[model samples]
Target: MQRNFEHRKVALGTCGRAYNTPCIHEHSCLRCSLLRPDPQQRGRLTEVRDHLLARIDEAHREGWLGEVDGLRISLAGAEHKLAQLGELTTRTATVHLGLPHFSHLVGRTVR
Candidate 1:
């Protein structure tokens, strides 16, 4: 069966109604079978990344090597997604803001 799903309320951090897969894991979206993240989720993604970092730190401090390893993997994924989305938003935003593509050219002497 081909299952297709688009995330709905990311703020709630649950599978969207469109989700049809049976896979579920902690921070469901992290390991969801139908994980399809949208650019609009940048903010939430950042929050997730920060939380994962904290968890990784805590695990290491408590000598939980196994847990720390898992959290690091998830954290790397979140950071990767954030970078992808950040680049996309920056490109589109530059056009919308009527700014130069070369950031170094911004806010300089215009004589």
Candidate 2:
């Protein structure tokens, strides 16, 4: 898992829930709802999203309607994952709470 996390960020996002089974999504990790995306993988995820956008555009230009639909689904999933990563950064902003003084609580009694 550690090696996968370090090296295969583009192809696989960590799934803490899955055990001893091949991915039912056939390694389409971005489109799989079970995927747990790592914020550290944001660069790779953005690349994937950009590529998907180019493919969708190409599919439209080539009149590949079925291909376009499938690409759009994957695109939506990729975008959702990107949004999750965005939220993670903002949500993890730390607010420091300094250590409490025991003296302050020493004489305090709970009612």
| Most lDDT-accurate candidate | 2
Per-candidate local distance difference test: 0.67, 0.80
Q: Candidate 1: lDDT over CA atoms? A: 0.67
Query: In candidate 2, how many Å is residue 42 off?
Result: 0.6
lDDT of 2 by residue, 17-105 (tens): 43556767777888887777987788998999999999999999999999999999999999999988878778857878999778867
Candidate 2: what lDDT? 0.80
Q: Give per-model TM-scores.
A: 0.54, 0.69
lDDT of 2 at 33: 78
Off by over 4 Å in 2: 1-12, 93-111
What local lDDT score does residue 66 receive in model 2, on the 0 to 100 scale? Answer: 100
Which tens-of-lDDT digit does each residue in 5-50 have in candidate 1?
4344454243544454444565556644334467878788889888
